[model samples]
Target: MIDTEILGWRAALVGELDHRRLKAPSVKLRSAQGAADGEAIYCVDLRVRHPNADHYLTSTELHSVEHFLLEGFMRLLPAHFVSVGIMGCQTGFYLAFRNEGRAGRLCDTLEQILAAIEHAREVPYANIEQCGNYRNHSLADAQRVAREILARRADWLDAA
Candidate 1:
């Protein structure tokens, strides 16, 4: 059931997005397992660019972005849960999907979903008492990134 035409969104995003490892140019990733296949899941990191590369996000903002995707993806792919978490740089999120075989199918669905999210205005789990660190959500940044991802989809989203 492997797809020959689709490169998969995880790989495409990893190939197209501004990866930190690639950005640094000097750092190299090592393995404790001594160079294994690494993972069975599909992982994609989504990033946003500010005018200055130095411009990073606040904790709350990162929280918002994480929560937004956590909610969106969970709802979008209800058959399976989606793990959406923030990158260490606070510029993006890491999405891990256990159903690796569905990457191509998900990519097609994601393009349609992302294309429809015109202006996102809410962070999913922004509860002061319920969430570990609340009030750290930014609908503005989330919306910006959503729009950005949609616009960049033509470059990074296609499965081919």
Candidate 2:
């Protein structure tokens, strides 16, 4: 990482972060000040940006995926994981895990999650009684993305 400050806040130019050259999905861990206990927190990002691809996930895919990942991780890592969310730009997911050791397990955990996504019959909580806009879930698109991720998993797994 190259620190290149611009206007005010600190920043760094992360090398090989380009979507085109990426092999597998990976997250970078960084410690920072600001938490409930005033201790450093570890942050990780599971980016899904594709190179030269301007298109993003459709609304249905996004809606379904959110519920799937949230529940999936809650089932997978239990207490060690914090949260799973989609990136605002629609490029990928954001996962916040506890510490460095979790980073090592990130790829494997995601592989399992993707496998579940591939085999799932429907989005977990897509019901009028369960969710606000529950009709917008799309299992097809979610599975498509899961296949894509699985294809690239080897590339990323090695890096992670």
Candidate 3:
């Protein structure tokens, strides 16, 4: 069973999204739980655009962004990093982490990652053997989306 206290924290985390002006490219805490090993696990939805928005990330853009994000987080936060996976809706990604309490720090690291993506010249691991659909990736589209997300960094987290 999930702890009551943890549920409250989850509520608070989800509440942060209520205050966001720009719905797209924002991070929303989806769930949090305490592990048997005494660690807190956080699952966040990295919304590329509002769920209700008319457009979504193209397959190529999503694939490229997924590659960049996975590589970037692994490089930047290996200690706390868990994994990043593309959303089925093609609107964003799901980011998981362990024992990370500071939303501000996450935001900072995300901005850095996005900045790197903005300037990235190539998508990581796009080779035939490395990726299933290697041909369906675009560095330019990924860069464009990264810039859009960076522009709304302030909306990534709620006011403390």
Instruction: Give the candidate number with the greatest lDDT.
Output: 3
Q: Order the numbered candidates by TM-score, best leading.
A: 3, 2, 1
* Cα lDDT, model 3, residue 132: 95
> In model 1, which range of ten residues has the least summed lDDT?
25-34
On TM-score, the leading prediction is: 3
How well does each candidate superpose onto the true structure, as a TM-score?
A: 0.63, 0.72, 0.84
Which pairs, if any, clash in model 1?
60-136
Model with the higher lDDT, candidate 1 or 3: 3
Ranking by lDDT: 3, 2, 1
The sequence of per-residue lDDT tens digits that candidate 2 reaches over residues 19-128 is: 55543344443222345663333455566555347767677777787788778878887866787777776767766765323444766777888889988999988898
Which residue pairs come into collision in candidate 2?
24-156
Residue 109's lDDT within candidate 1 is: 54
Q: Which TM-score value belongs to model 3?
A: 0.84
Question: Runs in model 3 with CA error above 4 Å?
Answer: 1-22, 158-160
- Tell me the tens digit of each residue's lDDT in model 1 across 58-130: 7766676667667667777766544767778765666766544354555555555554445554566678766
For candidate 1, the lDDT comes to 0.52
> What's the CA error at residue 150 for candidate 2, in Å?
0.8
